[model samples]
Target: MPFQHPETTGHGYVIERYVTRKDSDHPRYLELNGAHVLRPGWPHAKRFARHLIDDATTITDAELEALLAYEWRSRLTAAWLIGVDRRESFRERIGDLLLASEVCYSGGGFCFALARFGTHADAEILTAYLDHYLPRTDLHYDQPDALGALLHLDARLGTHHADRITEPDGLWDEWVKGVGRLGHPSHTPAELRRWTDLHCDFINDWSRS
Candidate 1:
């Protein structure tokens, strides 16, 4: 299902305003314009990752949903909170956003949240995104992270949903061919690991502290 933005008129607009304002002080709020926490700059968001986890636990679902309707920053923040809280209800909506690829940067959050959900339904959603987007060789959205999420899901659920995608001369082939033209590597295991760990760090590492 496509993600429908609530009519941004009276109350909807207020919701948007509320979330946007709420996301302002997030540690990596400014980084929402580009790739999220797992970019080249190691530890950029690490010091404050725990604080965000603390915030995620307390934020209400209504606010998180409203944040999803706002800018990438708000959407990313909402995704993290939803994941930390394990709010599985938002899985479909986050998958919708991943497929829409409507905005930049937020796809990481969407993918991460779906992975954290760790269910077959979540895997299906990730598969759906790959089915639709991977063939579009000219585009570079969240395909890598989506693939990584599927991999994680497969490992958790004991399913091979991502096998064909990562298979030889398959959709993964198309993705590599497309990204190669742009001088980017065909695979980014390090980035994928970082993305996967970012969520784990929030859930485990922070809890220990």
Candidate 2:
């Protein structure tokens, strides 16, 4: 089933499941400048991110944007993999995607990913979603990811988000340093705010009730 953004009448993406093992976590070649040389159909999203991080300085913006269409995970992965080097491309291209998406897991992922990977300008991009959901009654049921995105963005960009976030302090504290266990801070789910390694005081009370 293809799910779309509620706000967008006909905009959405599909999560493709890989049937066979093909792409490897390690790239075929690693450049001296941390640039990862990737072939056309590499399967692993982590490998792609590793490549991006490795080649943060050398990879071209066009090359990074091109990877956005590679797969679902990679698309989001690419958003975070994008470093401060070619921020304009990420702001332009990824910003377009984020603005087009409605409030959902994918949106939150994009929200968190970009906010974490993005720079000062990203604060503007993230607050819209954060403020949008923070006021909703359903926030108790959903929106930890969005909240976390704000915290991550604030922490990273030094933006004063503490005033904007009206949610309980306990909820905000759930977002710890180092992006939690959901991989990079950008990769964390918009709905989940707990850490896998550390003991946290968060449970989906809405679900339990």
Candidate 3:
């Protein structure tokens, strides 16, 4: 039996189950970004966006924001997947996708999604995030996803916006140190090693929660 979240529609298994199942029987689905799962199989991105907006009641404000951010990430991933398959439709969506990518919050998930897209627009969004969010002491910087996104965005976008990234204070340094281990395609081996060491600790803490 599939485990279910109360929040799930129960029309099918939740995304976690869907993704794990995709790894085996449905490799093509694997290529579909987890972010895209926000819309499932919708033919049009705008339709997908509408679905999300309609389903807004099912999720909290933070989760809705995360999903919006994830949706943009998924669009980029979909573009890449379509490009790999030589699909002409992918080209048509690129501009719209770039615009959608800007809707996400400046967290690691958002950043990772941007890095995955790796477009000029993605770089601009990442730069804007660093400028608007990092300077605020009231905002939490401890989330690994946010740090990972920043690190990956930095690696992909380079030092063009480096001056904007303030030094990590509070748990920000620890957060970056943790994400360094996850070893995204965007990171160097040295960066990966450092991140992995920190990430392991982070994971251990997360497991306890």
Which is the leading candidate under TM-score? 1
Candidate 3: list runs displaced more than 4 Å.
1-107, 141-151, 167-209
User: Residue-wise lDDT of candidate 2 within 40-152, one digit each (tens)?
Assistant: 33344345334334554554555455545444444544454453233555666665566555323334435545544546666666666555544443333124545555555
lDDT of 1 at 16: 39
Worst 10 residues of 1 by lDDT: 14-23
Candidate 3 TM-score over all chains jointly = 0.34
Local lDDT at 139 for model 3? 42
Superposed Cα RMSD, model 3 = 14.5
Whole-model lDDT, candidate 2? Answer: 0.41
Candidate 1, overall lDDT? Answer: 0.72
Q: How close is candidate 1 to the true structure, as a TM-score?
A: 0.78
Return the TM-score for each candidate structure: 0.78, 0.45, 0.34
Global lDDT of each model? 0.72, 0.41, 0.36
All models, RMSD in angstroms: 4.2, 13.1, 14.5
